[model samples]
Target chain A: MHVLIIGAAGMVGRKLLDRIAHEDGVLGGEVTRLTLVDVVEPTAPGPLDAITRSLALDLSDAGAAAQLIAERPDIIFHLAAIVSGEAEADFEKGYRVNLDGTRALFDAIRAEGLKEPYRPRVIFASSVAVFGAPFPEKIGDEFFTTPLTSYGTQKAIAELLLADYSRRGIFDGIGIRLPTICVRPGKPNKAASGFFSNILREPLAGQEAVLPVEEDVLHWFASPRSAAGFFVHAATLDLEKVGLRRNLTMPGLSATVRDEIAALERVAGAKAVRLIRREPDETIRRIVAGWPRDFDARRAAELGFKAETRFDDIIRAHIEDELGGKI
Target chain B: MHVLIIGAAGMVGRKLLDRIAHEDGVLGGEVTRLTLVDVVEPTAPGPLDAITRSLALDLSDAGAAAQLIAERPDIIFHLAAIVSGEAEADFEKGYRVNLDGTRALFDAIRAEGLKEPYRPRVIFASSVAVFGAPFPEKIGDEFFTTPLTSYGTQKAIAELLLADYSRRGIFDGIGIRLPTICVRPGKPNKAASGFFSNILREPLAGQEAVLPVEEDVLHWFASPRSAAGFFVHAATLDLEKVGLRRNLTMPGLSATVRDEIAALERVAGAKAVRLIRREPDETIRRIVAGWPRDFDARRAAELGFKAETRFDDIIRAHIEDELGGKI
Candidate 1:
């Protein structure tokens, strides 16, 4: 089987690449080649014999998507997107890249007609940002998407297109609405939600971190490792069971900022909790306020997708993965 | 006030034009001009004193929408669409004309800026098709849009775009989700739902009619007169009262086929029911099966959008408006 990953340069994309590189053998069968494509060329995921090609080109470019679809990989992972902050700030660029770019890719595949007998698996990385404020007790699978930001709206639109295209039999597709990845690796990014992970990761490594929102602020999460696992599971699953509604909200653990602090204390120490400095930023607060604190990912769970049960385990997993078990 | 009507040649559009033309100096508090656009040139409504301009061009054409936006009318009524059955049959054209065309019009308006605090009222004609199967007893303001057809998907997307543009202060936009218009005047069209009107309409007019579905197949509806009223209300609404959610489900009467027949009997006597032939068609059954049966249009009613409380009243109103109160 050959697999192609779009946005293969992003953090979760790299992890997905690493997983596929190491686990070349499939669930009861054989795995052969892996192809990675992004706006920027992706770094090679070691020297796995099963891996073959890597390319860098903007997928949104008019003819570029058609070219990519021509390769006809067995599975395609579309993870490319302009982030929430960037999409909100640059409206035209955001709609162009997020909406038009995504639609172009879908159109390219449809125009190609799945090459007769075989149809590729298309896995889309959607986000929880699709849900907005005035959320219910736990956002059920049936909840309507009234996205507060342009990024969320774009994803919601993409989800609809994916379902429609899949129904047309262009490709067997699944959209996974991933919770924000907690303890996100590398330096603290500019994403408003970055503080959720930053406060935990920084404090665990004995570095001071800013707490822009109140400790009582609640949010949903999954770790980087679990997110990759969810995608892999989604790609390999039997899609006939998914029916016409191919999109599902991936399972996640709902935690409060104070719960995160407690988890840090549990995994690291009280000294680490103390390292979190409270400096409330209204901009971050307003942004975070619009997000869903929890979701009832019943569909995803029923489909055999999994996530970390405990926030402490999520933090400890990050420490084990990034710091070589030093924490 | 200058009013621009897209799809002005359509059935409902023509009725709206006639209503507006006749009430020129009344409801509008004096009108100055009317810009009518459709793929085919719309006939002028009588010999009106107001400046009436008719243009025959596809609004989806690259430059056409922008050019229309440049006119910057006081009220823009966008009633154009490829209907459900046709849209489902031709997916690409449905999306291009319905979705892309709508977006182009919106983008053009936003590009023109506020033009010194003047933003034209954009009233979009959305459809009840936005809601699909596994419907509630009564769909409310917050029901999720899980459209069963491509036409519904297009309308749902357009509704989102309208809300977003309105939020950005580019235009004062409103989308009215019209229920299936019953007792439609003129010959029966190709719409699967056409039977809903045809069954009652033809019988009442002493013509043969076919009842394709079982009597218990309930559906939502508003008369043509009510739909015209909805457009007028949507155009003049103080949108600030609508807040960020610009789309609204218009008020309608919900009844089963049996109820419709009973109403027809009560209004036009048993002789009208005698004209109905019971011949079920599988194709029509499959299509109508997915339609929404009812809606709790509380928000629309609170905003003064009225509809018939009884099915007989709806049929009688249609007769009164279209056939001089004689059936």
Candidate 2:
């Protein structure tokens, strides 16, 4: 089956691409054609059994969404978004890209469907940011979305559109609200949440990283490997069983900084743990405080979407995938 | 104070206009200039203490929002919307009028803010339809909005935008999620929820009305006068106390159909109650079944928004307001 991946250049997107390219297929179907899309031209993988097409496209631009939908791939993975920090900083650009861009894509698919009978499996990569402050200890599937940031608000709106459009039979849609991908395989950026990954990723790479918040502060997480698995599972899941609500919170390990340190020590010894400097930044601490600490992702867990419950497993997965098993 | 009414031609809007005209002012200030807008020309009320301007302008049309915002009224009442049944029938029109129109007005206000420190009080007319099926015994203030219908989805999205904009300080906005206005005056339309008002309204008007659902069917409601009061209170309330969340579910009476009938009998006698014809409609029953039966509107009540709790008071209100005391 033909598959389209928007924002195919991001870390999770690349991982998803790798999974499809290496696994030979997904959802019990061979990836006969791969369409990779991003604002910048995404690097296409090596020639596989399937045909490969890569395109540089900005969804916010007029007619861009229609052009993208014109291809009509059987399965479309929309992961494109302006990051939280960026969206918050640039209000106009954030709403333009995140809200309008996403809506344009949905409208385009509807326009396409009007021309002929076509129902594609549309898998949207949503975020846990949809829930804001004053959250319950374990946010249930039924909890309402009240995003604190513009980026979160945009995602919430997009999720609403996905559910509505899916209900209308415009497309078979499923929105996966992914937890933060622990040990993001890259250099630490300026994001406040960057410290979560930096402390772990840098220590594993034998580098120093600042521990921004208290060790006991808990947050939800999943490995990069598991993030890819969610999109793959979403494309194949029996949505009829999902009933009217299409969006779901994916299962993830709810761990604290101390847990991460303990896991690091277990996997890479105290030497790696020593690399984490206890430097508290009140700004980051305050920002993180409002974030959801954990969720009752029972629906996702029951629906074949899996995640590492133990932070040790998360660390091991990171080492195995990013460091080639040499920590 | 300059007051701008976007849907000045609507039932609630006309009531609001009447309220302001008769009150001689609103929010403790004299209504110096009143600008009324709707798709069709709204009839200017008879001479009031304030100057009135009624214009026919569709908010979804290009430049219409900016032009409306250009006037920059001190308090803007946005009550315009396509009803639920119509929104369900015409998808494009719904999005265009409900979603895009609302956004355009907001963007225009934001643009106005950019030019100068112009922040208008934007009071949006949202609906309880924002909350969909599988509700709690009484939906609380914290309950998330997951509207089952396209109309509900649009209102929910608009509520998000309202909060975000209010938080950003671009516009001081408030969204009042009014309950089903019981005893809606005038003719009964083909809406599934029409019976909620019809059984009480038509019988009081000495006209027979059909009862589509069982007597045990419970629902939430507020009077047209109370809906108007909510907007007025929203305009003048200390929004800083509202915090970041600007949307609120107004307090209303939650009663079963039997409660309505008994109240009708109490006010208009059994002879008036007998004007109701029993004709069960499965389609409407299924639709009404998904509606919210009750709400814990504690927050709104705390904020000084009031509504009738007894179904008898509701009937008396309709009779006193619509039929004069003689009825």
Candidate 3:
């Protein structure tokens, strides 16, 4: 089977690629050819480099999606998007990349199918941001999407299109609404939610990281490994069981900042825990407060998708995946 | 205040125009100008003809929305759409008119705002088709939208755009999710749901009409007058009370075919009810089975948007509005 990965240069995309390369039978079939697409050309993993083709393309540009869809890959993973802050700051750019870009790709697939019979499996990376503030105690599978940001609105719209197209047999699509990836690898970022990862990742690396919110502050999270696993499972799952609602919120661990500190103390000792310095920024705190703290992600869980049940397990997974199992 | 009606030729649109002409203070302001647009030119009401300009313009056509926005109408009523059956049959035309056309109008508004500070009250005519089958006893305000048809998908996507644009202050928009308009003033059409109106309408007009589904088959409904009232209320209501969730399912009466027949018997006597013929179309029955049966439209009700509470009142509305107040 041939596979296509859009946004292959991004963090989650790279993780997915690594999993497909390193794990045998994870995709339920042999991936004979791999096409990696991004605004910046992506590099393939060493194991899959021989069969991989990388291309730099912007989906929103006229005819770009058509060029990609012409190959008719069996499974397509669309993970590209403009982040929340950037999308909110620049409305036009945000809509162009997030909304129009995604629609272009979907439309191209439909146009390709009109020539002959062709229906490929489409996996979309959605986010918890599809939901907004004043949420219930635990947002259920049936809860509405009232996005507080433009990025979230774009994601929600794409999910609707995916479901509609899939129902029409244009493509077999599934949207995985991922939780915030905790201990996100790389340098400190300016995103308000970045502090969730920074406090844990930096401290584990023997570096000081500022704590932006109270220890009691809670949020939802999953490891990068779980994120990749979600795409793999969605690719092979029996879509008939999913029915008309193609979008599913993936299972995630809901924990507080104090829980993270406790887990850090258990895994890497108090030295790493003490590396987290108290410096509350009211703006970040206020922004974080409006985010969803928990969800009854029953549908995803019932479909055999799994996530770390404890914060300790989440930290361990991060340490094993990013720290080479030596943290 | 200048008002623009995008689908001034459609049933609810014409009713809105009639209301504006007859009811004083209905819009809470003097209408300085009225612009009527449709795929075909719309006729202006006699009372408002001097201030009205009728145009034959298709919103999906390039530059049409921009030209309309250039005028900067104070209140814009967007009621145009490719109805459900047609949208289902022709996919490209559906997306072009329903999705792209709506976006074009919204973008045009934002572009006009960039040149000069201009914001308008945008009242969009959405539909309850946004929800699909296997609903709860009564779908509440926060239920997720899982559209079953292409038309519903387009409406849902437009609703998302409306909310995002409204949040950005590009336009003060509100989406009124209209229930199936019973006692719809029109000839017997081929639409699956047309029987909902035909059964009562034809019988009241001293003509025969077929009843396709079983007597126990229940559905949500409001009158044509209520639909116009919903748009009018949306235009003048304090949107601050609506908060971030701009779309609302308008209140409607939930009744069964038996209830409708009984109401008809009461309103126009058993002789008129005798004009009803039973045909039990299996295709239509199966189709109607997948539709939403009821809703908890508390939010729209609380916002002062009123609808007939009883099926009798709906029949009475048709008579009072369409039959010269005589049975």
Candidate 4:
């Protein structure tokens, strides 16, 4: 099967590519052709024994999305987006890239369908930020999307467009609202929620990291491997089972800061847990206070999507996948 | 206060015009200027002592929204839309009018705000069609908007845009999700829900009207007068009280077909009720089945937006308002 991956250079996208290269026969067929795209030229994951092409394109630019859709890959994965802090700070850029860019792609797909009987499976990487604060103990499948930031609002709007386009038979589409990727690889960046991964990742690598929030503050997570697994499952699943609601919240592990310390202690050593320094940042605390901590993703679970149920499992997966299975 | 009405020729819009003219000092200030617009020429609802202008302009046309916003009416009422049946049949036109037109107006407001400090009160005419099936007995303010039709999806998207723009301080906006306007004035149109009014409206005027659905079919409703009142209340209500959820399901009476028939008998005797004919329409029945039957509009009610609580009261409102206090 031919496949196209947007934002293919990002961590999860790269991991997904690596999985495809190894599995070969996954996605319900053999991987015969690949079209990888990103804002910057994305290098092929590894040796490709099939037809392959790479393009650096901005979807928000006029005619760019149409050019991409014209290729008509059998399956397409869209993962490009501006992060939360940038979106909140720069409103115009956020709407231009996140909202307008996404809509342009969907509209391009619909226009393509007008030419012939062409329908491709589209997998969008959505985020749990679609749900804001003042939530219930466990946000259910039917919970409303009331995003507090510009990024979440953009995702929620794109999710609506995805459902509408799918209903109109333009494309077979699905939006996976991914949980926060715990133990995110690479150095910590500017995302407010980056600390959730930082404290565990740095300490596990024998580097001291600041614990910005209290240990009792709970949040949801899934490892990068589990995140990739969700895309694989979504691409192959029977869309008839998904029904009219095309967007779904992927199942994730709900844990607290203390849970991370416990898991790190179990995986590495007591010395690793002691590397976390307690520090209180009021702005970060206020922002984190408005985030969703738990979700009842029964629909996704019943549909055979799985994620790490324990924080320790998440740490183990990170170690096995990124750390050569050693401390 | 200067006021602008986007669909001033429609049922609720005309009533609103009449209300403003008669109330004299409605909208918390004396009526000073009126700018009325519709796709066709809109007739003056009543004598206007204040300066008024009427125009025949489609909002989707380039520069039309900008021209309207340039005048900068202190309070703007946006009631223009392609009805549900038309929007479902013509997808392109639906998005062009319902989605693009709405966004064009919002962008115009944002641009106006950029030029100077000008933020107008924008009251949008949304619909309960934003809610799909599989709902609880009484849909709440927090219910997710998963529209079953193109029209509903467009309205839901507009509601999201309204909230985001309000949060950004570009404009003060409120979206009122109107229920089916029972006893709607004039001839029956193609709206699937039109029969809910036809069965009562025609029969009350001593004419035969068909009932397309079962007597047990329950639905939510408010009179055209009540719908106009929702806009009036929305125009001046303190924005702080509304908080962040800018869209509201307006309060309306929930009753079955039988309840409407009984109300007609009590208000105008069986002679009027006898004019009703039963002719089940399979298409309309299937469509109506997916609609919301009731809503728990507690927030709207708490904010002092009132509507008839019983079918008898709704019928009386029609008679008193439309029939000039006579049956």
Candidate 5:
């Protein structure tokens, strides 16, 4: 089987590619032909290099999506998107890239099918940002999407298009709404939610990190491995079971900052816990307050999608995956 | 206030125009100018003819929405859409008109604002079709939209865009998700859901009407008068109170075919009810089974949007509005 990964240079995309390579390029079938797409050309893993082709392409450009669809890969993973902060700051660019880009891709698929019988399995990367402020204590799978930001609105619109296109038999589609990836492996950024990962990742790297919210502040999380796993699972799942509602919220650990600290201390000793410096920024606190703290993602869980139930397991996964199991 | 009605030739649009004309052209403020637009030219009421301008235009045509926005009508009532059955039958036409046309109008407004500050009060006519089957006993305001048809998907997407644009302050927009208009003032048509109105309408007009689904089949409805009133109210309401969730499911009476028949008997004599013929249609029954039956529209009710509580009142509305005062 041939597999196409859009936004393959991104973190989750890279992780998904790694998983496929480690498993001998089998995602339900042997992925003999691999196509990686991003705004910049992506590099393939050593094992899969010979069979891989990388392209630098922008989906928003006219005819870009049709060019990609012309190849007709059996499975398509669409992970391309303008980040939340960027989308919110630049409205035109956000809509052009996030909303218009996704729609173009779907329309291109339909156009391709019209020429011949072609229905690829499409796995879309959605975000929990689709759920905005004033959420229920635990947001259920059936809760409404009233996004507070432009980025979230774009994602919600794309999810709707995915369902409609899928129902029309243009493609077999599934949208996986991922929780925030905790202990994101990279240098700290200025995003309001960055502290959730910075405090843990930095401390594990023997560096000090700032804690910007109260210890009791809660949020949902999954490890990077689990994020990649969601896309892989969605690609292979029998979508007839999903019916008309193609989008599913993936299960994740719902924990507080206090719980995260406790887990850090348990895994890396008190020294790592002491590395977290208290410096609460009111703006970040206010922004974080509006985010969803928990979710009842029962539908995805019932469909055999798995996640770490314990904060300790999440921390351990980060260590094993990013820290080479030596944290 | 300069008011513009995009689909001025439709039933609810005509009702709204009648209401405005009856009240001497005042919707929250004195209406100094009126602009009516439709695919074909709309005739203005005698009372407002001097102040009204009618135009024939299709919103999906290039530059059509921009031309409408160029006028900068203070209150814009967007009621244009391809009806459900037509939209479902033609996928491309549905998206082009229902989705692209709506977006073009919105983007046109934003572009106008960029050139010069012009923020119009946009009251969009959305539909309850946004909700699909397997609903709760009564779908609440927070229930997610998982539409089972292309038309519904387009409406849901338009609603999302409405909310996001309002959030950005490009325009003050409100999407009213109207229930199926019952006792719809027109000749009987072959729409799957047409029987909901035909049974009541044709019988009252001294003609026989076929009853498709079973008597126990329940559905949500509002009178054409109430539908017009909902748009007028949305045009004037303080959106600050509504916050960022700009879309609302309007209040409606949820009744069964038995309830409608009972009401017909009450309003008109049993002789009028006797004009109904029973011919069950399996295809219509299957189609109607997937529609939303009831809604807990408390939020809309609390927001001062009112609909009849009794089916008798609904029939009376049809009599008073469509027929002479004396039935």
Candidate 6:
């Protein structure tokens, strides 16, 4: 069996590569080749025995998506996207990369069926950003998407198209709206939701980090490892069981900033918590205020998807995966 | 106050003209002029006395929308659409007219503000076909749109664009998703849902009509008068009360075919009920089966929008408004 991963240079994509490399055989089948695609060439990561291929190509270009899909890989993990900040700032680029790129891939797969019978499993990484303001205490499987940003709008539209095309028998597709990955590895960043992870990850490594919002601000989260796991599960699951509705909101942990600090103190002692600063940025506060803090994952859970039960487990998992089991 | 009505040659458009003319004043203000636009030259509905003007132009043509908005009408009624049957049968034309036409009008409005401050109340006619298969007991303000057909997709996308543009302060807009108009005045047509109205309407007019589905299959409905009223109410609404969320599901009556036939029997005796031919057509059944049966329209009701309370009232409304209470 072979697998293709798009956006292979991103954080979760890299983690997914590592997991699949170790597993060797996936879903009771021998994994022979892995195809990695991104705008920038993806590094092979480790030794390969003549079966791994890496390519750099723009997915949104007219013939690029068709060229990539013509190889007829059995499974495809589509994880490419322009991030929220960039998308909000640059409208044309956002629509081109996020909307056009995604649509082109789907159309390519559809056009392939004319030559012969072809139905590859496609697992798409969507986001909770699809749900906007005036949310319920726990958003249910039936919630409408009234996205407030261009990025969210693009994702919602993609979800609609994916479902429609899948119903039309183009491919077996699944879209999972991931929660924000907590304890995101690397230096502090500018995403308004960054502090949810920054306040802990930076302090745990003995570095000072800025706190941009009030400690009571609540948000949803999943670990990077869990996000990778969701893609694998979606890629191998019986899509017939998912029925005509192919999109699901992945399970996540809802935690407040105070909750993060409390969990950090429990794991690495109170000294780690003291490295945080207490300046509140109003812009970040206003943006964070509108995000959903919880979801009712009834449909996802029934289909065997899982996530960390506690915030402590989430931080621990990130440290173990990125820092090699030691903090 | 001046008003512009696009697609002014269509059924509801002509009815709106007659109503507005009879009312003399619209939105509690004296009307100075009305611009009626359509591809086919609309014959003047009644004696205008120098208060009305007509223009024939394809709204989707380049520069047409901007030129229309430059006239700076106080309110704009957008009633243009390629109907469901045409939209589904011809994909390219469906998208060109429904999607591109709506976007051009919105972009035109936005461009006007770049030169000078201009805002118009835009009342758009959307449809309940936006909600498709696998329905819940009562679709509420927060139900996902999984449209089963191309026409539904176009309307749903338009609703998103309308909300986003309104949020950006481009225009004060509201989209009303009207229910299937019942007891429609005309010959029996090709529309799948046409049977819902035809079964009773043709019978009352002493013509034979087909019953295409099981008697227990329920569906939602509104009278043509109620639909026209919804457009007027949306135009005068204080959009600040609606804010950035611009699309609303209009109120309607939910009844099964048996309920409809029962009402017909009550209004015109056993003779009208007997006029409905009990011939089940599989094609119409398949189409009608995918439609939504009911809606929880709390938002529209709170905004003072209303509909006929029962099927009996709906039948009575059809007779009173279209047939002068003669049945």
C-alpha lDDT values of all predictions: 0.85, 0.90, 0.94, 0.90, 0.93, 0.84
Model 6: CA > 4 A from native: A1-4, A27-35, A47-58, A70-73, A114-117, B1-6, B27-44, B48-74
- Please write out the lDDT profile of model 5 over residues B162-261, one tens digit for every residue: 9999999999999999999998989999889899999999988899999988999999999998998998888879998898999999999999999999
Q: What lDDT score is found at residue A191 in candidate 2?
A: 85
Decide which is better by lDDT, 1 or 3.
3
Tens digit per residue, CA lDDT, model 6, B230-297: 88788777888886678899999999999999999999999888888889888888878889999998
RMSD of 3: 0.8
Cα TM-score of candidate 2: 0.98
Across residues B189-229, which tens digit of lDDT does each residue of candidate 2 receive? 88888898999889887899999999999999999989989
Provide the TM-score for each candidate, comma-separated: 0.97, 0.98, 0.99, 0.98, 0.99, 0.92
lDDT of 4 by residue, A172-263 (tens): 99999999998899998777898999998898888998888899999999999999999999999999999989899999999999898888
Per-chain TM-score (chain B), model 6:
0.96
* Interface RMSD values for all candidates: 1.2, 1.0, 0.5, 0.9, 0.5, 1.3
What digit string (tens of lDDT, one per residue) describes model 2 on residues A1-327? 878888999998998887887786565697778888899989866755248788899889999889888988899999999999999999999999999999999999999999998899999999999998888889998887888999999999999999889889999999999999988998998888888889889988989999889999999999999999999899889999887788999999999989989998999999999999999899999999999999999988888899998999988998899999997
Error of 4 at B219 (Å): 0.4
Best by lDDT: 3
Query: Which regions in candidate 3 have their CA more than 4 angstroms from the true location?
Result: none
* lDDT: the better of candidates 4 and 5: 5
lDDT of 1 at B138: 91
Write candidate 1's Cα lDDT for B95-142 as tens digits. Answer: 989999999888888877745455788999999888878888999888
Q: Which structure among the candidates has the greatest DockQ?
A: 5
Model 1 agreement with the true structure over A1-327: per-residue lDDT tens digits: 777788999999988877776675542235576677888888866655335677888877879888888877778889999998899888988898889988998888887774444467889999988777788989988887778788888988888888877877777889999999998998988889999999998887888999999888989999999999988898879898888778888999999998998888888889999999999999999988878999889989999999998998899889888899996
Off by over 4 Å in 2: A47-50, B47-50
Candidate 1 chain A, poorest ten consecutive residues by summed lDDT: A24-33
- RMSD per candidate (Å) reads 1.8, 1.3, 0.8, 1.2, 0.9, 2.8
Proportion of native contacts present in model 1: 0.32
